[model samples]
Target: MSVTGERLKALREARGWTQEEVARRLNVSRAAVGHWERGKNEPSYDTLIRLARLYNTSTAYLIGETDDPSPLSAAQGRKRPRSVPPAGWGRLTDRQKEYVRRVTDEMREIMVKELLDGEQ
Candidate 1:
């Protein structure tokens, strides 16, 4: 089995869940779960996030990007994955969003400076 498929199956089995059960919980088809576990297809980005959350693991781990199983929340104070915007972002005012963008840019600059300093 592929790394992702193996990981997915292991996580679900570790939870003592059937593929059908996982499908029901994720609001997807049982065949979809089967496809994932069999490595026939991959889940979409949003579905991948939901799957990671459901399995209580990180997408990086699930996708073989990292061995770390730590959730994104464990990286507190770290910038969130750009694909997943901050909560309630859509509800924010345009001016508030702009302010947030500026803050994020400032934080990125600070992080870059810190990394450079550490290297020196």
Candidate 2:
């Protein structure tokens, strides 16, 4: 079987989720999930990224580029300079905005820690 298919199946099975459950999270049909796992088809780049997020893994891992599931460090992860109130941030409700802020802050902290750890 394809590496991508293997990883997808392994990750989903490891989470004890059925194809239907994964489909629900991906907003796709169960057949889509089955097709992906069976290597009958591949997800688009956008869907691959979404899958990585849903599985709490790195796109690299999903695509068989790496064994590590941890997301890229901030430097590698950031595709562009971060802007305050990033596009669409204003569209979120106040509570959602706060949640985004908290998550962003936590991610920053984790990035810093990773950087420090690498230096040691």
Candidate 3:
């Protein structure tokens, strides 16, 4: 099975949930969950996002893109390399750099929106 399938099964088992229970929570059929666990199929991006949220994990972790289970939200204030690595940015991978960039962008957007709203 794929890493995603393995992780999904492990997460479900860890929660002591039956396939039916997981399916119910995900608003999918039991067979769909089974398929996901068996690596017969993968969830759509939205469904994957839902799964990550439901499991309290990150989409990257669920998809085997990263081993970190903590979601991006967990790093809500970690938009800078200085925050992520007090030492420096040299330790960051390309993927981590990209993640920092994305977080910074999101934070900037939110700050702009809030500032504009306060002006009203």
Tell me how many residue pairs clash in candidate 2.
Answer: 0
Say which prediction, candidate 1 or candidate 3, comes out ahead on TM-score: 3
Residue-level lDDT tens digits of model 3 in 78-117 = 3444355423347665855575455445546755786678
Clashing pairs in 2: none
Encode model 2's per-residue lDDT on 17-98: one tens digit a residue.
9999999998999999999999788776668778878888876577554567777656666533455445555665685456
Name the lDDT of candidate 1.
0.74
- For model 1, which pairs clash? none
Candidate no. 2 TM-score: 0.61
Query: Per-model C-alpha lDDT, please?
Result: 0.74, 0.74, 0.74
Q: What ordering of candidates by TM-score runs from best to worst?
A: 3, 1, 2
The residue-level lDDT of candidate 2 at 2 comes to 56
Worst ten-residue run, lDDT, model 1? 71-80
CA shift of 35, model 3, Å: 0.4
> TM-score per candidate, in order?
0.61, 0.61, 0.63
Tens-digit lDDT track for model 1 on 67-101? 66776442255455878866566876685466456
